[model samples]
Target: MPVTTRTVEYPADGLTMVGHLALPAGADRRPAVLIGPEGPGLNDFQRRRADALAELGYVALAFDINGGRWFSDPEEMLAYVMPLLADPDRMREIGHAALDVLRAEPRTDQDRIAAIGYGTGGAIALELGRDGVDLRAIGTINAVTTGRPGEAAHIRCPVWAAVGSEDPIMPPAQREAFTAEMQEAGVDWRLVVYGGAQHAFHHPTVDHTVLPGVAYHARHAERAWHDVVGLLDECLPVVSPA
Candidate 1:
């Protein structure tokens, strides 16, 4: 199926967020997926993911966290994202705004949507699950931070998280804590640790170093993507019409 792409502007967190929407061919409703960007905000990388999902017959929306801007400076990006991480309510608000945009689309199957995010975007997706949103599934990469006490109990769907074993930001202790929270909450969750990979291993290589411990691992990136697709296939499978 051919894929179509467009830019959508929506209000969120006191800024006009610019999201990239990709639609699969045909007017019939399809399962929608939310694509969240890394800490640096929405860029060509995430937009391409949306397009790829569309090509696979899904309605995908790559949402923005830094409104319409993309930050190449790690310090500048963290200065903005760090505060939001502390405030779960604010992150949920941003996720909900994008969800609203996605739900409003005529081609979306409201009840069969899933959320997949990377880096900071991954945290947003997890927050949405903690907020008791109706999601078919939640998948994230490299944002394994634990949520507020008892909040994981609110997650009503299966959760999948992935991280590089050598990711300093999401060390063994942090991953253990996150898994403990999910287990205690009785939520269905799974975590995959890619050995010998560093933080942001799923991201493509950049000209300059974005942050310490952040590097791209081509092999691990592909494997992680395959696993995420498997998660969606199991939880939100799209059946073809006869």
Candidate 2:
């Protein structure tokens, strides 16, 4: 099915967030998935993911947490995202605001919502799960854990997380710790580590030259994307289009 796209604006912590919303053509209501960006704000990567989700008969919203801004450099992006990460409440607020926007869509099934995020965006999605948002499933790629002890226990939905096995930023130890915490919390979760992959493994634009520490692995990216889609399909089962 063809995808219809629109720009939406909503209030978020006194700032107006402008996001891109994509839905499958036709008027049938469908499960919605909120797609969050890696850092700074909305970008082509997140937009593409939203469009892909729409093709799968979902109403997907790519949220702009940084008010529609983008940074080509990693340092600049970190400068913007760091402060937000420091404040747990702000992170939760941003996720909640995005979730609200996704739910408010006329063609979205509010009760059957899911969220997927990458990097910092992934962390935000995890925060939403930790806050007990009514999401059916949550998926995170190259996500950063809350680090704070026992944070995983609060998550109520099933989670699917993927990270590059060779990623220096999110190393095997961290992944192990996160898995341990999830197990302790008794949360339904799956952790996948892609061998030889590095940070931001799903971003097509990412290259070793531009971001010295990051390398995008196409194979792992494709596999991880399918895994995420499968998880959503299982948890948020879409109604057949009439």
Candidate 3:
């Protein structure tokens, strides 16, 4: 069987949002994986990841965070993403819009859905889990910003977060806060910190990054992706071809 891809555009928050959908070559409904990219929005890296997941028989959607726009400048990206991070409601709106698109697809098995996000997109995935979106697994990398204690109580799925030991954006204290919040919420959660890696370690392309705290580490990136796939397999295993 082969993998296939398509473009899905939808109206969101008065802006035309775009996403890349990857479908496995099968007739059976597959477990869906929603990918939220870094603050730079969806790009080739995220789309490639989606396609890889689809090759493993998961229907994957790489959704946009900034109306299909990406920023090469760190200040500009933060200026756009910081406000959304501060507003949990807005993040949930963006996430739910993407979720709706994934669930509407014929190949997606709505009952078994997982989300993986990087940087700002990771926060959006976490926000969706906090809003009780009924996801099976939530995997985040370099974006372990904790939600309000009360809001975290709504998360019913398992969460797996990975970060670099030296990443300033999500330092040790922030990671502790996120773990504590997840513990208090009684959510099944796991966190991994890789040594010698920086923020956005999973990013393969360095040209898109221009931040002081962000760098790409190939080894850690591969390990983090494997860990995320393991989480999804444990919580939302896809059916094999018949």
Candidate 4:
């Protein structure tokens, strides 16, 4: 399927966030998926994912919360994202701005919208859910959560989370705690752990074996992609032709 790409403007934090929107062929209004990128800003991998989602019949909006920037070093990335993550209100505003942009697109069915995020972006998605975004579903890949214990309870949409078993940052213990918290919050949530995978496994930038200290499993990455698409299908069904 062919895809169409366009730029969108979202105003927040006294700055304009420029995002990429991708739509599938035909004149149909499709369910939209708001995709949040990992760290700094949107990258090629995210843009490719947006195109892939468009091919799957969704109007995919790849959001730019970081105002179009990239940081190669881990410390530098953390330095840039930590403050934003710490301020829940700021995160919520940014998320709402992106959601607004997605919901406004003529090709998107605002009522059937969903969101998926990666890493820090994943955290933002969770915050959006906490703030009651009226979404169909939300998914996070290798995401981190910092809200209160019972915060997820109020979310009306189903939540799905995927993590790497070998990820040192989000280890088994943290994942277990997060699952327990979700259960206590009465959230309809599923947690999947990809065995032998590490943080950012889905990122194409991570090599298979060269990063000695980090583990990256390709099999898990491929499976995770399919899993995300399947989840979206379940949450945001395609409207039939009249």
Candidate 5:
């Protein structure tokens, strides 16, 4: 389907976050998705993801984290994102703000919305679910951060998380802890660890190196995207009118 793209700006975390909105070609309301950017903030990579979702007949919003800025230096990105990760409130705030933008669109069917994020953005999506948002599904890539004590219980939708086996940032212990929390909370969740892949494996090649143990795996990236689409197909499928 032909898709329309636009720039959206919203306020969150005391900064004006600029996001990219993609609308599928249709007159009827459609299921919407919230796309959170990686720790480096929103960039062309995320914008293209939104466009892909739009082409798939869904409204997608690629939200920003650093007030319309993109960070190339790993240290600089970590300097800004580390503190945000520690503060769940701030993460939820950013997620909710983006959700609001998605919901406000006339093309969006508010009842059928999903949140998917990459890296830091994935953590934000999980935070939204932990905060009890009414998302149909939550998907994360390379982010398996455990939520607050007993907070996973608030997630009312299916959770899907994917990480690379060699991702040092989300090692086996961390993945175990995250799954344990979900199991204890009784939330329906699944975790996929791609063998031989690294952190940010889903991301395409960039001009500069992001971080050690962080590289794109083309095969695993396709597989992970298939898994995410399956999750959405099951949890938030868009029905065509007869």
Candidate 6:
């Protein structure tokens, strides 16, 4: 079946967010996924991932983070995204806005929604889990961060996270802390550290020259995608429409 794509513009907080939605050609309801891009915001990379998920018979929504704008420079992207990460409430609001958009689609099986995010977008997906939104699976790449320890208890789904072993953005110490938090919260969680891969290893289009701490590894990217899709298949299985 051919996958269809469209732009979905909606209001998030005070910003007018522009998200990309992809739906598989089918009449049956299917599990939905929300894709969140890194601090630079939504781009071709995330949009393509959404389309891929849709081709697998899922409704995928790649939502905006920075008001439909993406920054090329690292300093500029950090300057804009750092503040948003500091405030959990704001993250929750953004996630809620995107979640509502995913749920509103007629083909979405609301009961089996999942969220996968990269960098800051991963953090937003975690916020939705912490807010007790009842997601089936939560997947993050190079974006796992420990929230308030108590908040993890509200996450009612299995989580799959991956990061490059040499990723400066999320080092061993950070991963350890996040692991401790997840263990304490008793959430079903899995973590993978790809050897020698750098931050944003899953993003093939990301330019490491412009972004100092990030680099792309095609092999690891493929492995990470397989892991995430496996998580979704385990948590939110969809029967093909004959």
Q: Write the per-residue lDDT of candidate 4 for residues 1-242, one digit (tens) a residue.
A: 47899888779766788888999988878999989998757877888899999988899988887777766666777787889888888888888899988888899886898989998788889999988778899899988575865667768898999998888878877888878777888889999988888888887754323233245568888999999998998989776557
Candidate 2: tens digits of C-alpha lDDT, residues 1-242: 47989888987856888898999978988999989888757877788889999988899999888876777777887788888877777888988998888888899986788988998788889888887788899899988575456777788899899998888888878898888888898989999889999998988854323555688799999999999889998999888865
TM-scores for all candidates: the values are 0.98, 0.93, 0.97, 0.92, 0.98, 0.97
Number of clashing residue pairs, candidate 6: 0
> Model 3 lDDT vs. the true structure?
0.90
Model 5 per-residue lDDT tens digits across residues 1-242: 47999999999999999999999887899999999989999999889989988888889999999999989899999999999999999999999999999999999998999999999999999999999999999999999999889999999999999999999999999999999999999999999999999999998988986788999999999999999889989998888656
Output the TM-score of candidate 4.
0.92
Candidate 5 scores a C-alpha RMSD against the true structure in Å of: 0.9
Query: Candidate 4: what lDDT?
Result: 0.83
TM-score, prediction 3: 0.97
Which segments of model 2 are wrong by more than 4 Å?
A: 206-209
Q: What is the lDDT of candidate 1?
A: 0.94
> What's every prediction's RMSD, in angstroms?
0.8, 1.8, 1.1, 2.3, 0.9, 1.2
Residue range 39-97, candidate 6, lDDT tens digits: 98899999999999998889999999989898988889889889999989999999999
Clashes of 3: 0
Model 6 TM-score relative to the real fold: 0.97
What is each predicted model's overall lDDT from 0 to 1?
0.94, 0.85, 0.90, 0.83, 0.94, 0.92
Which scores higher on TM-score, 1 or 3? Answer: 1
Candidate 3 lDDT over 51-120, as tens digits, reads 9999888999999988888788888988988998998998888999999999999989979999989988
Considering summed lDDT, which 10 consecutive residues are worst modelled in model 6?
204-213
Comparing 1 and 2 on lDDT, the stronger one: 1
Q: Cα deviation of 41 in candidate 4 (Å)? A: 1.7
